[model samples]
Target: MIAAVRPQADPPPEATRAPEAVLPQDVHATEAVRATEAAHAPGAAPATARRRPMVAHDLDGLPVPRAAYPLTRLPRNEPHASLDGARIVVSGGRGMGDLAAFPILYDIAARLGGAVGASLPAVDAGWAPVTRQVGISGKYVSPDIYLAIGISGTPQHLAGIDPHTRIVAINNDEQANIFNVAEAGVVAEWQVLLPALLNALDHPGDA
Candidate 1:
């Protein structure tokens, strides 16, 4: 036998439904919201009470204040030697030997109108000031011409040197790492080379 189908009735409308009973917690929460709204309403008193101005009391037996002292400005020291924007940089390393080599390096730098820089060991040995040191731990430089004197060309030292600069390495050891990166190299001792270079600079035709 075939069964007859019956349609389900639709749910009641929200407007016609009875309102839900408010719980004790919900009643308390509604009262709190109303209280907050009333407290912040226009012409309502401030939530926080006004405080009285505080009076500072001096301690008995305190010492009298001292007179104002005048301060003198400190005299400026010699200007710091910077290599940031130099046209050329003549840098020396430990291979140049002792503090004596620095003056020669400085002279060369001066003649070339360049700045003087130093490697870690030269600075540590007191041959050059800390301000002149160049490496990862020191100043980074990018000059038109970078004249590296007796520098072994460690990765750390090379890190401070710009790759675009024309590197001229002067070292007695032909196999020195500096030669690998140098655009031009001179395999000779600084003692012999420096004097010759200075003399050449003094007399260009003789050079």
Candidate 2:
């Protein structure tokens, strides 16, 4: 639904200033006053006329077109660098069920200082909101830690997450595809695992 933007050509430079006219003492003083008035004219100063507003180009009593300053920001080197704190991402797969448990996922994400995301199937099934979907067709997420629960790792789903990110998966099936990409795995159901996770977080060092 977006329209293509046409590239714009750079504007031409301003015409050079004419050499100052030499005149008698009184005439020279009057000319100086006129120059000051011209410099303080309304509008932006030209590149050459740092302290003065640029005079319009006059060709045979006719004025040429005027131009505005191109105040644009150039591309920076660290484009992907994050100015904010570290991010943690929690993504749910098909095992998350009808998304009736989304609140629990949101709560977990809040606890872990992260955002919530969902797999393609969960998004398609209307379990998770479209904004939270992760995959080629969804938004790409590059969080510091990626925790995937009840998910089967699909290439499409993995495309949304960074390859170098730390991944943790939770699923009952030990042979699930998600385990392949997970740095850590726990063979457990989310319904039970979530409570255990909450308890462990609440009571740290009390294993």
Candidate 3:
């Protein structure tokens, strides 16, 4: 015997159509959603509670310093050449031979409106002041022009000089280590060279 078949019913029109996406703003418009958001906000207070203002009292309780000493101004000495940001540095070393040579170095530096610097040995030997010492253990200088007279290019001494500075070396020994790093070099000693330089500065008109 054959069996009888029945027809199936179709889905409703609402089920067949796609639902519209709900925006966050649309959800927030509901009273329940708005209340939940208010509960999570930073430093949020209950709707029934009254808020109290906060005040800072740290400065009000802080102690101020009072001067207990006499008000006598100390006598200020004249300012000397500062090594900081010097455009031109005329530096010397033990090869300067004598303390007398320092005065000439100073004169040359004064003529050139530059500062005077010395190597550690020169400073240690009392040839120059400790303030004028330029080396690894002393002041670091970055001058545009570094007139290195009688200085041997030691690692310690070279460490204090800026790599960008243009070095001009003057020494009696042609094979001196200074020449290795010097942009310009002279085989003459500082004694002979400095005097001529000063003379040239003194008489610019003369060749």
Candidate 4:
């Protein structure tokens, strides 16, 4: 007996249409997509980065640099003549911080009729003015007597003093480094020594 024939059917045309290509997933969401699309759309060019211009501000209402007055160069001048007859050079150092000590030195210098000098530290610390500084970076002084009060005799301070001048250092400590360079070392407090010196000066015949 012959088998019954089965009917053949064609695939639906819509199904045959290449399965609609899967569109790329918008990973970022709508706003980002819109921004990206706006940035890279046809006929859209990348923006040029802009540089900000520098703004000038006047300094505390001061005039501008170009408008400021030009400084004039003054003629070089020499210092006044040193006193040749100056008998003594009374010098002080940083150790003399006690404000009370100043008057003693001042009085001693006045009595001896000598100029007052200062070490570099004293000047730098504002204890003494720069004008009175006697050191490597200050005035070089040569006098008959160099009385150093509490000075430790740093090389810089010694640089300004004359080598031939008789150096007298007064300090409370006997082992002070100043004693090494002093011709006469007095191991007594300057506060005590100064008054004693003043009294001796005032009284002529005293042992």
Candidate 5:
């Protein structure tokens, strides 16, 4: 942190006089003349010293002590999931229609050895937990591959994603904003698309 110092007031000028010319051979005479001049010169009164006023800064009431809050431990249900370390992320959104499709989304992520994430609307609609939210208001993600299902790409949501991550967008709307940033896109309804994807995952050769 940088701090600024206040400028101080200038001091008063000192009293001075020109020296008298003295002969080189008359050193004692020159000393006598200088003594006479010093006796005749008017005496200057000593300047009165100014003392700075004592500044008593009382910080007694300035700070407010924080109150100790009661801590309660919640029951642990499952292992903690984080998006930052996830290599692949399969995310769902409001366009998936309902929370019923989350199981299929989760299954796809599990099969691919990835984490499950959700858009803000999907989390708000109770389709996924708040911890899985991905957006400017949620956790930032930089996974190797990001699969966006039924999610419209909003600037706020995209802001949380790393630009280097390969994006794959699947949406019913062909003209979705997600397509602009996605490396690959598929336009299809999730109801038909999800089951087909699961089937492909089950039987890779048959797909």
Candidate 6:
């Protein structure tokens, strides 16, 4: 039987950096540098017929695959805002209730110096733009902090979030899957909590 396993966090950025052009201890590392030099070298023979070394079915009977980048894109009345490299992402879901919740979400994001994201349902319900959708079919996000409001963590949604990102879930449902993966979670209604949060954000320390 197949078992579910949560993804582990990636190593530190410095540790994940590409290896040096030539590592003294690694003889194979020098090949990349040598090949680069050979590419620009004068009168160097081109490797036109070369293919990857692997064990596979007969190439003679297989069809070649083709791919292409889109040349044209659908235009929109309002320009789409990208969520790439956002430091903080305040995402909402269908559980956020009516359309009024979105303005509050946007306000919160602005106050936090972050971007807004949404689940598929919210996008389809016309509460949020498709550009703001986060999921397997949507844009992948690797933010420092992801604050999920009224979002039930679905595999489709979670797939878009990086393992390194810190998740903070705010949901009324006690059994929400979001809490399973969240670093921290709050069980409360966003309507009640968001207003209070906004008040706190507006006034730092007044009783």
Identify the leading candidate in terms of TM-score.
3
Q: Which residue pairs show backbone clashes in model 3? A: none
Give the Cα-based TM-score of candidate 6 against the true structure. Answer: 0.61
Provide the overall lDDT of each model, using Cα atoms, as 2-decimal numbers: 0.57, 0.52, 0.57, 0.50, 0.57, 0.58
Better of 2 and 3 by lDDT: 3
Q: Alpha carbon lDDT of residue 199, candidate 2?
A: 49
Q: Candidate 2, residues 73-182: lDDT per residue as tens digits?
A: 22223322221233787778788776466666665576666777889899888877787887778877767677788887666677666655656666767556555545
Model 3: residues with Cα > 4 Å off, grouped in runs: 1-79
My TM-score estimates for the predictions, one after another, are: 0.60, 0.56, 0.61, 0.56, 0.60, 0.61
Show where candidate 5 strays beyond 4 Å: 1-81
Give the per-residue lDDT of model 3 (tens digit) for 1-207: 111111122212321110011111111100000112222122334222221221221212222122121213221243446778788898999998867667777766777778889999999999888999987788888888788888876767876777667676766675565655554455554554465566656655552
Each candidate: how many clashes?
0, 0, 0, 0, 0, 0
Cα displacement (Å) at residue 169, model 5: 0.5
- Poorest lDDT segment (10 consecutive residues) of candidate 6: 26-35
Q: Which stretches of candidate 4 lie over 4 Å from their true place?
A: 1-85
Tell me the lDDT of model 4 at 175: 49
Q: Per-residue error at 38 for model 6, in Å?
A: 40
Residue-by-residue lDDT tens digits, candidate 6, 1-207: 111112133312332211121111111100000112222122333323222122222212222112221213222334333589888898999899856678777666777778889999899999888999998778789888788898987767877887667677777784676755565445566765565555555554431
Better of 2 and 3 by TM-score: 3
Instruction: State, as a TM-score between 0 and 1, how close model 1 is to the true structure.
Output: 0.60
Q: In terms of TM-score, how similar is model 5 to the real structure?
A: 0.60
Cα-lDDT of candidate 6: 0.58
| Candidate 4 clash pair list | none
- Candidate 1: RMSD to truth: 38.2
